[model samples]
Target: MLDSNETIVAIASPTTPAMRGIVRMSGQSVVPILEAVGIKSSQAKRAQVIQSRIDLGTPLGKLDIAVSLWPTSQSYTGQPSAELHTIGSAPVLQSIVNVLTTAGARAARPGEFTMRAFLAGRLDLPQAEAVLGVIEAEQRGSLEHALNQLAGNLSRPLEQMRSEMLDLLADVEAGLDFVDEDIEFISDEALVERLSVIHAAVDKTRQSMESRGGNRSRAIVAFRGNPNAGKSHLINALVGREVAIVADVAGTTRDVVSVETTLDGHAVQWVDTAGIESRAQHDPLFEITAASQAHALRASQNADVRIWCVDACHDDLAAQRRYFETHDGSSKRSSIDIWVATKSDLIDSTQRQPDWMYTSVITGDGVDRLRDRVSQFVASHDKEEVGSIMGTAARCSGSLAHAATCIETAIRFVQQGDGHEFVASELRVAVECLGEVTGAVYTDDILDRVFGRFCIGK
Candidate 1:
């Protein structure tokens, strides 16, 4: 539990200059400091209320400040808290913090305020972590999911699971302890059934977490093909800027160039790699070394989507198609490949249009359709709902995987008719692993690692 006596202060607003800013303080001493700063409390029948200007006399003159005082047990951190709204000027804000410090309030450390709330039982471990998630969220889907978790959506289910596990553990312990008395609290069949149900529920929760649509939707898409495929032109058209150098000369782009864009509201890192071909070694930077080829292959293998651009004006579209058809057999199943026929404006009037898209970056012809196709591919292919899944954090993933392993071992033990105590021990380990996810058991190092990412005011 946090000590109410140690008051802390921090600037609550962003560091950037703005029209207004706020400095917040919380602890038992906050009310007294507010009073000293010219805020007077008055008794009205049964309750006390502050009814004066929040700003006290300044060295130069009276400053315009808005202050709200929250008394003990009625504040966010479960302590007396005060919020001082002042001008956004950096100097003015710094002065306010200095004054607060001089008045005995110490500067708050990173995440100290939120950590205090957790210790005071105002918010649990998962909800507190959600605060950081909400702050760092880069997309709307992630923000919504994090807000849902912060509102106790995630914690409610975990609490129910924990309670169920505790009840089962109690039954097993009672059965083991009073075996000689023949109490028969839990039969072997009944124990196995309960364990099976618990395992299934945990597995379902893990799957749900993995399928949620949020952070996982963020992916990198790389454009790769043979020489003079108009990859640079396509990238520039997508981002609506001169993000990459485009030239009619083959192999103009010898390195990877990238731009950030949102496709159908999903964040994407679009990269244009050097054209792949059999070329002689020349300039070290431009040379297609074995390492460079391996790197390109690795990027293609790892990309969420690969757009294979074929220059319709020169290259044989059918040949490019055949190459990809053969390559698809050896490619990773996770990659989504698309065929793009570039420089379509130069196609002959009698030439037949292939099944692939025809795009001309110069005239912006078919660009919209290309973008639509890309969006459609992402929507149809990467349909996993990341927000409902469990493995957003490495720690959560490790815990759930560990729990699954433990449960699997325990099931084997039960099937082999092993000692009941051994089965119980494995089940206990599984429960402990789940407990780590909700921070039911945590060390100082764990706490530091979790909260260290937060800003000082949060």
Candidate 2:
């Protein structure tokens, strides 16, 4: 862990030419820096715009700056903190940062200020991740989600669930420790019932989280089809630009080509995958193509939406069904599936499939409808997903997923009326996983994943 005892400083505000700029500091020695720089004030939270000499010992230059102090330890980082305010200038801010670093204060790393808050019990792991979400949010829906997380919307429920799980864990472990006593603090039936409730709650939370997150944060919409089906052209038409390779050859795209755009203020990531074939011949080139298709299929399975494209001029129901079976994730994911027959200009209107969207890149038929459909799908998902899915970070979701698996295993053991030790072990895994989400239980790796990319001075 980075040393929090030593003072750390960073320019809190943008270093652009503006009316004011801020050089913030957090540590035990924060107040002393202000004192050494001739800031004498006992009042906290008040911005004292008094002129003071910023001493660097060696002559870089002298400047007058305003200072504010949080002289107590109950500040943001649970340490004495201060912010030096001056006219907004990059060189001026850089000079102040240099001076602070020179005077026993080191530069704070990305997310260090927020990480310090997390370490000091000010914010939990989910909340810490939410800080980044707020920073990276591109739309209002995402911004609202981040602000909700910051207000403890997700953390509060997770905390309750963790507290209950901790109790159950204690009971299970205690029973194991005193196996000979035949004392049942929590009955097998009761344990089974409680575990079931938690399992459902966690499952509900995970699903809701996945949906809200997938929809709000750049939801991946993948286009899967046979070779020469005009998938690239379809994407280009939708995005109003040439982003992918369009060609007449089979196996043109041996990799997933993705582009990001916004629809109705919701960020959408559109992916055009390599054309997948059902029957495979034993050739090196075919194997490579198959491998690329497999990777794209996995991505498609997780994508928020899937656009399964087929040639409009061709008639092959079996091939279409096979493609749908492999690429469509309607049952497994909180997602939408759209079957599209591309190159519609060559086909008669009577030849169109009843429910399938038929589009032609050359004639521009159905392109606007397809784009509007996709946008409506996204907007609807954003509104409806909150009921069944919540969007937490990937790390937290993975932990929740694993915890759910462990809980399921424990419930089975309890129902089987055997293997108390095995049941206890499963409970431990579930609770520990749950605890990691809230930072009640964490490793250095978990900390790194959560806070590593945070901007300095956050």
Candidate 3:
């Protein structure tokens, strides 16, 4: 558990010198801190503002500041919070923070204020993450998504579903407790009906997370293939720099690494992900390898364009033909897939697939053609709507996907005339999964992952 009893202080505005900067404070001691700085406690009441000066003594003299106060526990952190706005000089801000700390305030940790708001029930998990998203957003579309999420556009439905599931679970468990009595707490048909609805809602949310591409302002071009297919070299060649590590060994890239550049006037982010390999998660030897494969798969799915890099010297053309014939580029209508024969310098023209693009980073062959193809794809979809999901939504996707599966299993149990206890167990897991999405249920690890990325003073 986190302690919220101590007074915390931080510089809330940008550190760059400007006309004004704000040093924010939260906790029961905020009023006392103001008094120590020479501002009257009474003057710093809720919604009240005071023009004041803090005497730093010696060379710095007294600095003019504006104080905005919420003397009661109803501020952003659900505590008595105040903001001291003064000239945005770096030294002045530091001096003010020093004054507050000496008086009674401790410097706040990164995202501590927002985390306190979450712990106090002022904002749910999704809303708290959205606050960070708003702070870090670089493009207009990302900002819009973050704002909408902050407004409860996504959490509202999930919260509603969780509530309904709780009611259904109560009914199902009640039926088990009264098996000897002549009362039907819940009908089998009703149980299935409610679970079906929950399943549908989970599936809808999952699809949105999966379909949302990264950063609409720039196109995501992902390189994917089996191990040692020259993906790293190709990305280096395209960017004209050594962004990804190149090696002759398999599985050199275990995580997704990307570089941003302009391709024929179109902004693009080229991603080099781990090689797609067969590995069993249950095996201790392949556990980490399997994780890397999963990361690669997710990157490819979110990409706007997948560049399939096939090793020209080693891969069998017949198998490649079969794979491409059956698989579509992507489920997303806007996404495209282009096959490329990599390391073309090592193979003869007769050995390469006629329809596929050929490229060799060593000899600089066909790199420009590959660039032009990706640029064309980006231009065609320039006007398409982007920003399908907030980045934070990625976390909820797994939870919601699991909830959907659990609900489906519960539905099956009900239909098959399984014991009420078995049905209740499935519903319990399903409810917990939904709870994780909205933060009705959470662990310390979840909190750390969500808030650790925030900049201090947010």
Best by lDDT: 3
Model 1 quality (TM-score): 0.61
Worst 10 residues of 2 by lDDT: 384-393
TM-score of each: 0.61, 0.61, 0.63
Tens digits of lDDT, candidate 1, 281-301:
565644454455556666677
Residue pairs with backbone overlap in model 3: none
Model 2 stretches astray by more than 4 angstroms: 43-62, 216-392
- State each candidate's clash count: 16, 9, 0
Evaluated against the true structure, the overall lDDT of model 1 is: 0.72
Q: Give per-residue lDDT, candidate 1, residue 353.
A: 62
- Candidate 3 lDDT at 244 equals 98
Give per-residue CA lDDT, model 2, range 1-458, as digits (tens): 77878789998887679989999899988766766665677565543445576754445567778777777777778877888888888878888888777767889888888888888999988888778777876555456567778889888988888888889988988898888896888998899888889999998888767756565656678898878888998999999999999988887888888989898798889899988765458665777876887878777876877888888877774577575775544432356678888888887888777878989988889999998998887876576434222434566789899999999999998898877889888988888898887899988777877778777788
* lDDT digits (tens) for residues 1-458 of candidate 3: 45787999999899997999999899989888888889875544457888888987667989888899889877888888889998898788888898899998999988989998998899999899889877876555456567778999889999999999999999988888899999998889887887887889889887766555333456789898878999999999889889999999998999889889887766789999988767665777497887877777777877888898888876586687467435433434457778888889998878766678999988889999998888877765543324324446567878888999889988898888889899889889988998998899999989888888788888
Candidates sorted on lDDT, descending? 3, 2, 1
Better by lDDT, candidate 3 or 2: 3
Off-target runs (Cα >4 Å) in candidate 3 are 43-45, 213-390
**lDDT score, candidate 3:** 0.82
